[model samples]
Target: MKPTIIRPQGLPDSVSSPVVTPIMPSVVYASDTPDALDAQYEGRTSGYTYAREGHPNADVLARRIDALEGATGGIVTGSGMAAVTAALLGLCKAGDHVLGGDQLYGRSLRMMRDDLPRLGIETTLADPTDAASMEAALRETTRLVLIEVVSNPTLRLADLDGIAALCKARDILLVVDNTFTTPRAIKPFEQGADVVLHSVTKLLAGHSDVTLGWVAAKDPDLQRQLYDFIVTTGLTPSPFDCWLAERGLVSFDLRFDRAQRTAETLGRWLAGQAGVTRVLYPTRDDHPDRARAQALLRGTGGNMLSFEIEGGRAAANAFAAAAEGVAFAPTLGDVGTTLSHPASSSHRGLTPEARAAIGISEGFFRVSVGLEDPEALQDTFGAGLAAARGAR
Candidate 1:
């Protein structure tokens, strides 16, 4: 009358579970034959030679993410930016150029804008939501095109089909950052994506605890190259972080579903508020790219909302202070509803005019709806909106 997974042989055939993987923090592996070690070192064999190169926990997490993203292979990294940077480095040579989104996670933009150029890899920016703008930004030297599935802070949607087609026709790799939308909502690989990126710190893990990132690709050869690069650069995550992230994955859908429900309720409420300037959610009728979002994400809306108040930065700060349950987290995608101010937090490194150009105004604040009662969130966020109104 009970259902269970088939355990491997020698895994205690009784009620015991031998297949359940545990946190494996072993740094060095013991091998009897020199040939075995050499094979592992040379990538001829698929086995752990060292934790810095790969380990049990990271492998388990990577496999799960690989399956979820519909990729042939994947690898976990120390941090989200590490994953992105490492993948870019693996794909690009000294003279190669990259075309990336104008609206990205602040740190991601900064890395491409500042660091990549220093390494002789040029990066050009384009609004991925616009076909014409993206086409104009691509260069003959462009080897990769990076797109965020849902633009951070602003919640803009990317038209994946157009971008994918454009990149494919040019023999350029299309890498989709699926952190904002998560795999539960959208699988970029289905849209002709060459690879997919995730800040596993977000909805994939479904908790604010783990700091991890990963890249998944359909090509096994590319995966091997990425893994080799990871080993050479020491970009692997700790086994403990890998375990925690995988643990969070078990409940990701449940948490994301509940949070999305709350987000929808809060989005509708926020839009109707007299003092609120605008609410940005993919499902909203007023969203500029709602149709594109529907097409790419298969009608699944995300659990993120961006709103503006009348009083600019002052009001945004005051609003956070007034919220009853919503906490100000420098991060996004927490199981508990959290708030972030893009201008002062994530995108603070940019100039005022630069931030404004991306539709991030001084009054803009983003809300990552969590697994709270919709009514409670409405009350909490409503208080903040009301406070912002009073602050003006």
Candidate 2:
């Protein structure tokens, strides 16, 4: 006998129940009925009264993300920064403090350093890999402990479970940025994180086409608060973008798996190269947090890897220009591999001292391996390394 197939009720033949509706209907609201007016005007109802506040497509994506992250619920935003900003603002009060990992996305760092302070939310940066430092940094006024599963430029793995245990004892909300790992590799909530955030533009989307963000939380109250903030602040995603993200998520597992394999291969090759000084990838035995990464990550290391060149900025730029198969660009997790210099592209906004403090060297380069042939990518980097050496 064929295996039984269970389908969700009211779903069409082609689309899954968790997928967005193909056709959006136009409804005319009658102002005469008091009940209808109350349902439409009052935001208490759990329906999409307005597209900006909520939409069927957005809800579908949010539900899918929540399920993937194993969270009670989730909210989709226009951009990754929107997700980060809303998550922080929703959970933190005016006088509350936030402890963040030192190696956060450059834009996120700017938001914490410049924007949040203006709103009376103070933040302190700590090395996420160091549990003792994070524990010591936490204060009585700390409402949230923010950590990225993998640091951006350095590709260092954070000790999520250790940090979570620390935060749990202090009654602090543990917010994890799982953009680098994606849901296919690791679910932060299952690892003791209270909330998980993602920049869907990266590996989650799999193709660098659409920009979206998500916040998944275990607490129903926290999810509700995040949804309220998203709706009220008009930071919701567009229907078309939501649809694109949904399509991207369908093949996420395959893309992430292939890309991660390629990344690991490239990372190992780079580590053995003469011009490359330091290679940062969690799966590598030389990685400082290799054991911690093995404990936290479920699948391959991830698609992102970074290395420092021996000759610094000029050599790095020359190497990037000589790269063939991998495009010399800042954006990551694309169908085609892309590269960027952290000191210039993503972390350029930081002051010299600040950049140095974060360990973003002038010669450092970050590579986002894509769904390309592993050999082709390795050759491309090999050529780039040769060019860097020649330049030196």
True-vs-predicted CA distance for residue 317, candidate 2, Å: 1.5
lDDT (Cα atoms) of all candidates against the true structure: 0.85, 0.83
Q: Which runs of model 1 end up more than 4 angstroms from their true locations?
A: 1-16, 39-46
Candidate 2 ranges with C-alpha deviation above 4 Å: 1-34, 37-46, 351-354
**Residue pairs clashing, model 2:** none
- TM-scores for candidates 1 onward, in order: 0.93, 0.90
Worst 10 residues of 1 by lDDT: 4-13
Scored against the true structure, residue 141 in model 2 reaches a CA lDDT of 95
Candidate 1 lDDT over residue span 295-336, tens digit each: 777777878989988888778878989997788887778888
